[model samples]
Target: MHIAPLSPDDPSELGGYELLGRIGQGGMGQVYLGESPGGEPAAVKVIKPSIVDSETRLRFAQEVEILKTIWGARIAALLDADPEADPPWLATEYVEGLDLSRHVASHGPLDALLTASLGATLAEALATVHKQGLLHRDLKPANVLLGPNGPKVIDFGLAVFAESSVSLTAANTVVGTPSCMPPEQANGEKPLTPAVDVYALGAVLLFASTGHAPYRADNIHLLFHQVVDASIAPDLSGAPEELVPLLTAMLAHRPQDRPALDDVIRRCRALIEARGLKVAQARRRLTNFTAAPAHVLDDLLAVDRPATPGSTARARAGAADVPPGQGESEPEMLAPEAAQQEPGGFRPDRQEPEPPHTPPMPPAPVPRPTDPRLLFARIDTPTPPPAGTTTDEAAVKPDRSRPSARPAPRGGTGTGGGSSAPRRSLRHSAQARITAQRLREAYAANSPF
Candidate 1:
C-alpha cells in the first residue's frame, strides 16, 4: 500500500497518538499511519464526518468490540479505539506488508505449496474469528495482508457478532464484494453463518492460484448472478490438482455442503504434507515470497540526527541577530536563511524545527450582494481599441488574429488563418463513411458489450 504525506486537513494528533502519514482510505474513512508515545507504529482508521451518525457510531463501537474478542498471530490485534471521539477512530497493529491482491498483481499467483499455506493460515484465522462468535462477513483478497509471519486478516469493518440483537447491514442489503461473496450472501439469505466466510476463502484461494476470481464478469450484476446460480460451476481450471477438490467443496452452493473450518485446515495441511513439505517450511517459503524487505522498515523508523554543540551555538547566535517577526520558530541548529533555502528537506546531523504556534483565525463570512439581480447580471462591456486605431479601421479590418472556421490541414500549421485544400469529393466521403459503419458493425458483433 502507498503511504502518502499528511495533508493540511489531517489531524496531527488523535487520541494521544501522533499521526505520521496516511496509509490508505476506505468506504468508512481514512487509515493513517500513527506512532504511539513509545514510537510504536500503528494503523489508525478515523471515521468520516459524514458517517458520524448514531447508527454508524454504534456499528463502529460494535467493530471495536468484535476486534477486541479476536486474538491470534494471524490477526491484526486492535490496539486502541475511541468510538465516542469526534469522528470516532480505531487503531490496529500496523502490518508492514502489501495486501494479497497487490502482492498477486505485482508478483504472479502463488505456487501450489504457497497457496496451500495461505489457505491454512487464513483458515485458522477465520477459525479464531468464529471462535469469538463473530462473522467476518467480508473476507476477500484485499483484506488479507501477506507479512513476515504469515497471512494476516486485517479489516473487521464489516464484522458482526453471531448473536447480536442489532444488525449493521439492513435487511436485503448486500455488504461484500460480489465476486467473492457466497451464494447465500449474494442472494441476501439470512441469517448468515460462518459458512459464508468459508465460501469467500474458496474464492480467495482461487484468486491466489489463478490471479482472478472464480465467477468472472464485467460488472457486479453478472458476477452476483454467477455467484447465486447453483448450477453454474466455478472456473477452477488453473488451480492445483490437490487444491481443486477442497476448493470445490468449500465453494459449494449450499452452506451445509461446505466443509467446516477445521476440515478446511486439515485438507490444506494434508496437501502440504503430501508434497513432502512441512507446514513450517511452507510458512517460511510464504514469508520469503511475500515479506517486505528489512530496509523498508528501517526507512519508516528513521529519524533526524541531533546537531553538534558548535552548530547549535552558531544557530542560536544567528537567531538572536535576526529581528522579531522576521522569522518565527527559527531553529537553534541552522540560520533562518539556510532553513528557508530548503523547506522540509533533510539536513545531515540536524533535527527539524517545530513550527511556531499561531492563533486560529476565524473564518470570514461570505458576503451576499444587497441586490440579488446583480449576482446574475452579465457584463457586456467591449474593449477600447489602441489609441492610434480608429473605429472604422477596427470594424473593417478582418481579425486575422482569430482562428478560421475551417478545419486545420493535416500536417500544416494553422496559425496563418488560411484555408487548407478543398474538401474531399462526395464519392470519397461516402466511401469513408461506409468503411466506418462496417467497422462499427464488426466491433459490435465481436465485442462483449
Candidate 2:
C-alpha cells in the first residue's frame, strides 16, 4: 500500500495513536498509518465530519462491534476504536504489503496455482466471518492485502449482520463495486446469504488469473444490468482452463446456484494440490511473489522527512471549520490504571490541539455607496404618473421624504405657498418612484450601474 503524506486537514493524532501519514481516503473517511504508544503499527480509519450524522454513527458503532467478534489469520484484526469520538475512528493491524489490485496492475496476473491459493485463503476468511452471522457485503481486489503471510481481507465498512428481515442499504441505493458485485446484491435481493461473498471471491480469482473481471461495462448502469441478467453469463475468456468450471458456478446469476464457502475452499485446495504443492507451501509462494520491497514503502512514507509548514496550515484551517458543540477534546495521556481499556484500546498521551477560533461569517458586505452625483441623477430622472391618475392628483399625494405640508402654519391660512406645495410634493414623489425603478433595473441586471 502507498503511504500518502497527510494533508493540512488530517488529524495528527486520533484516540491516542499518533497518525504518521494517510494510507487512503474515500467518501466515508480517511485511513492513516498510526503508531501506538508502545510502537505497534496500526491502520486508523476515521469517519469524515460531513457524514457524521446519527445514522452514520450508528453504522460505525455497529462496525466496531462486528470487528470485535471477528478473528482470523486472513483478515486484518481490529486494534482500537472510538465511536463517540469527535468524528469517530477505528484502528486495525497495518498490513505492510501491496493490495491485490495494485499487485496485479503492476506485475500482471498470477498463475493458476497462486490464484487457487488466494481463493482458498479468502474463502476461509469469509467462512469465519459468516460463522459470526455477518456478511462482508463489499469484497473486491482492493480489499485484499498481500502481506508476508498470505492474502488478508480488509475494509469491512459495508459488512452487515445477515438478517433476512433487515435491509442493509437505503431505498434504491446499492453498495459494493460493480465489477465484483454479485447479481443478488445488484438486484437488492433480500435475505442475502454467504454466497454473495463466494461470488466475489470468484471475481477476485478471475482478476488474478485473467487481469479483468468476468463482466465489463463503461457505464455503471450497464454493468448492473449485466450482473442482474440471467442470460448474460460472465465472460471467462482468459481464465485458466482448470478454474473455469469453479468460476462459472460461483458467478451464477442466482445466489442459490453459487457454491457454498466450504465447497469453494475445497475446490481451491484441490487445485493447489493438483499443481503438486500443499496449500501451506503455495500460500508462502504467493506472498514471496507479491510482497513489495521494504525500500519502496519507506520511500513512499518518507519516514525521516519532517512535517512541512503547508501541512500545519491545512490542519489549522480544518480545525477552524469545526462547528460549536462538536469541538474535539484533546486525548489524555495513558495512565497506568487505564492500560487495559476495553472497547477502544490505548490511552492518548497528549491532548488534541485546541482548534483555532473561527470568527462568525460576517454578513455579505453591502455594496459601497456609489458617487453622490449618480444617486441624484437617478432621483432627478422624470417619472410619469401612475395609470388613470391625473398629474395634479399625483402631485397632491403625500411625500414621505419631507415633512407633511403643515396646516398653513396654523395662522394666516391664505393658501400661502399651498399652490406650490403640491407641485413640490409631486416632484419629490416622482423622483422617489424614478429612483426605485432604476435601482430595480440595476439589481435585475446584476450590476450597481
Candidate 3:
C-alpha cells in the first residue's frame, strides 16, 4: 500500500548494471530492481546515508560476514555486498512472483496442499540457517518470497547469531514489527534467542493460511501487551486441520516449548503427503476426482451442484475474450461464425439486436460464499489437531493475541455424534479437475529463475 518516488542515481556510477525501478524502502534503505552485469535480475538494498554511524557500520559488516558463510541456503542467496562503501549495499538474487501477502489476498487462502508445502519449505530453510549458528530475526511475510519453486526466505539484514552478546540494537532501535514479534522481544528483551524467529514464523504461517494477523492492534503498545499475555489463538478456519498441532507447537508461549526447525519441516511435509498431494509434482493423473463426503457445510450442501460435464465450453467462458492482436488467432476467427444466427431458433434478433461489439456470453460468475468455512474448504487438506487439547480462548497466555471464538456447529453441535468442528466440503468435478491440472503444468514449466 506504500508508494515511493524514483531515485535519480546513475546506474553506471553504482555498477555496470541497468536499474529497472525502485521496488521498496524501509528503515534500512531503498530496494531497487536491477540487473547484474551478466543479466541476472537482482534486488539491491542501498543503506541510507544516516546509518553510516559507527554502530550501523559495524552491524552491516557483521551481516556481510555471516551471510558469506551461508551463501546458497534455501531462501535467497546474497550476490554482492559492499559494507565499507558510503551508502552501503547488499544485492540479492531477485525472486519473481508475488509476495505471500499479495498472493493470499488475490488468490484466497491457498489450497491446503500448497499451504502445507509452504510450511515445509520454510522450516527446511530455517533449519539450514539455524544449523549454521544463525538466526533469521525477521521472518515476516515481506521477507518471505513465493517463487515458482515454492517459498524462499530472504533479507538477513536483521539476522543474528546463536550466541553473541552484541545485539543488533543501538539507541532506541525497535527490532521488529509489533504484531508478529515474540513476547520477549516486545518487552524490550535484548539478546534475543532463536525462539523469537520461531514465534514469528508461526505468526507468518497463520497469516498465510488465514487473511488476518494473529496479534493485530490499534497501536504497538496494546499489541505488545497482547504478546505478553499470550492470549491469541490463530484464526485457523481456512488452514488445514493437520496444521493446527504444528501451529500450536510453533506458537507455544514459552520459547522452550516450541519444536526445533527440523521437526517443523518434517511435520509440515507429512501433512502435505497425508492429504494426498505430492510435494515434487502436483500434475493431474489418470482420473478426475471429487470428494462429497456425507456430512457437509450447510451452505455448501445448499449449492445447486452442476451436472458432471466433459467440457466447460458449453457452460461458460471464465474471462473476457481477448481481441485479435491479443491472443491466439483461432479464437478470434471462430468468434463471428459462432455468433452468427441459427435458422429456426428463438433468436432475439427478431425483436432487436444488441451492440455488435457486445458478446452474447458473460463470464462465469465466481460468487464468494458467506461462510468462511465453505471458502476455506476450497483447500482440500484437513487441519486435524491432536486429540483433546482444549483451544479455549479465555485461557490464553499472558499475551492476549487470541482471535474470537467461532459459532458452534449447527444445532449447537455437529452431525452424527462426530466432533463439533467444521469438515472441508470439497466440490471438485471432472471439468474443474482438468482445469486445475492444466494450471499446475503451466506453473511448473514457467519457473524463469
Candidate 4:
C-alpha cells in the first residue's frame, strides 16, 4: 500500500503514538502509520470527526471490546485503543504486506491448489473469529492482507459481538460491500450468522480466481439488486473445476445452504491433497505467489526514528547536536582564550604538525629560592624597587635599634651579611608574617598551601 506523507490537517500524534504517515482512508476514518512507545510499528485508525457523536463512539467502543476477545495469528491483533479520545482511535499490529484485492489485481489469479489453500486459511481465520462470538460483518478482499506468514484479516470497523444488543446501523440499512454481501445482508436482515462471512469469502475467492467479483454492477442499487436476486448464480467460469463445487456451495443463495466454516476448511484441504500438494506446500506457494512487491514490503517495514517536527531540517542544517563518532572529523582542543573566541564552546580548528628531527623543549626553571627568608621576601613584594636603589632600601628596611632574641644563621651571619640579632629578629618576624599571610590567602582561595 502507498503510505502518503501526513497532511497538515492530520495530527502528528494521537494519544502517545507518533503518527508517521497516512496509510489509507475509509468511510469511518483514516488509518495512519504510527509507532508505539516501545518503537513497534502500528496501524492507528482514527474515527472521522463527523462520526464522533455518542452513537458512533459507543459502537466503536463496543468494537474495541469485541476485538479484545479475539486472539489469532491470521487476524491483525488489536494492541491498543482509546474510545473516549476526541476522534476515538484504535491501534493494531501493522502487517507488512498488501491487501488481497490489490495483490490479485497486480498479480493474476491463483491456481486451483493455491486457491484451495487460500480458502482453507481464510476459513480457519473466520472460524476463530466466530469462536469468539464475534461476526466480522465487513469481510472482503480489502479486509484480507497478504503478509510474509500468509493471509491476515484486518479492519473490524463493522465487527460486532453476536450476543450484543446494540444496533449501530439504522433499520433496513445495509452495510458491507454489495458484491460480497450475502442475500440476507443485501436484503438488510438482522442478527447475521457466521455463514454470511462464508458467503463473502466465496465472493473474495471468486474475485481472486476470475479477477472480478461474482456479481458486478456499475451502481450500488444495481449491485444490491443483483445480490438479492436468488435466481442469479455467481459466475465461476474462471475458477478451477475442483474449486467450483466448493465455491458454489459457499455462495449458496440461502445462508443455511452454505457449508459451515469447518466443512469449508475440510473440502479445501481435500482438494489441495487430491492435487498431490501438501497443505503446507500449497500455503507456501500461495504466500510466495501472492506476496506484496519487495519495494512495498520494504516501505512498510522501513521504520524511521521519530523526531519532533522540523527536526529533520535542523539536523540537516547542523543546528542539532552531532552524536560522538558521527562527525566528519574529530574536533581539536584549543587554548582557553582561543576556545572563547569560537562561535560554539568547542573549537573546530585542527592542530598543526610539528617539524621533523626537532629537539624537545626543556621545562621552565622554578622561581623559588633555596633560602626561606629570600622566598618570603619575594612573596611579600612580587615587583622589584627602582633599578638604582640600594639593596637595603630596595629589598627590606629593618629597624636596627630593636634587639632580637633569636640566634643568628648557622654560619654566624645574617641574611644581609650582618651579625646584628635585632636585624635578624626583624627579618624572622617579617618572614613569619609573610608565611601566615600566604597560608590565609591559600585557605581563602581553596588551594593547597
lDDT of 3 by residue, 65-127 (tens): 777877444568788888888777778777653466654554345545555666766777887
List model 1 lDDT by residue over 263-282, tens digit each. Answer: 99899999899988789777
Cα displacement (angstroms), candidate 1, residue 448, comes to 83
lDDT of each: 0.68, 0.67, 0.54, 0.66
For 1-449, candidate 4 gives per-residue lDDT tens digits of 54566778999899788887777898889999888778787899999998689988988898798888898989999989999999899999888666877656544567677778889999999999999899887888999988757899997778877666467788767778888889998887777888889999999888877778888889988888888898888878888787889889999999999999999999998998987867987787676445432222223344322111111111221222234223222211221112222233211121211111222232233354433344334433334545575545634542233222222222111112222211112222223444556556545565444
Clashing pairs in 1: none
Instruction: Give the per-residue lDDT digits (tens) of candidate 2, residues 234-339.
Output: 9998998999999999998878899999999899999989978789877766664565323222333333321111111112212323342232222211111111
Model 1, clash count? 0
Q: How close is candidate 4 to the true structure, as a TM-score?
A: 0.65
RMSD (CA, Å), each prediction: 26.5, 28.3, 22.1, 28.8
TM-score of each: 0.66, 0.66, 0.61, 0.65
